[model samples]
Target: MRQTRRIAETPPPEECDPRVEALVNDLIGRVADKWTMIVLEVLAQRGELRFTQLFRLVRGVSQKMLTQTLRHMERDGMVTRTVHPVVPPRVEYRLTDLGASLGAAFCGVWIWAEDNLTRVEDARARFDDRQT
Candidate 1:
């Protein structure tokens, strides 16, 4: 019998449990939201922010959408929300270590986007010119 390298190198799927796979799927499902990215980034940068403060800071997000995004982040353990009793009631948000790490990772992508935006616009213009 001849043993091929591919056969020798192949790992059995049984090595991975289904529960672990489900957890990975759930994690990806959570992290894929752009709104979540924005919320996490804001919290990471500002340290702490009131709900209304965040709504204003992240231009173009509706109050409903921002609330939903914050709820999801809190559920995922990426953010911590505290409610304080005051004249009008105050809620504050901040990122967890995990969330900070996520923000740092995406900040690189955001910086890259900022630095290359002009080049990207040029490419789009050239592509449009070719199309027309």
Candidate 2:
């Protein structure tokens, strides 16, 4: 049995095609949004969740923002929405394989942030002091 280490390197600029670069940049912009990242994290952890459950789990997110974020994720094929028909419609959202992969990829960013938090706070404090 072998354990594999995750690599966080990016391809060199010359190796990236312009169109692909543009699309990747756009996708990064979308997925890097606070709400999107939070939603991805929650779904990755909780498996499947109802809209209301998600709203509750994702603290401080408004119902409208959750709805919008879920729609965008579904549109991007990152999540699947299942509607259960009954007296009251029950809808649940689960991450697609693509979404799970994205969450795994973003884990590195979370790690980086955690590792750099103290440094970042010091830098911010210094900058604020200089501004005063």
* Highest-scoring model, TM-score: 2
**Prediction 1 TM-score vs. true:** 0.71
lDDT of 1 by residue, 1-132 (tens): 965435368864667898888976776666677778778777777889999899998988999999888888888788999999897999999998878877776677789999999999999999999999
Q: Model 2: per-residue lDDT, tens digit, 1-132?
A: 855534366445566789887878878999878999999999999999999999999999999999999999999899999999976999999999999998898898889999999999999999999999
Residue runs of model 1 more than 4 Å from their true location after superposition: 1-32
Clashing pairs in 1: none
Alpha-carbon error at 90 in model 1, in Å?
1.5
- Worst 10-residue lDDT window, candidate 1: 3-12
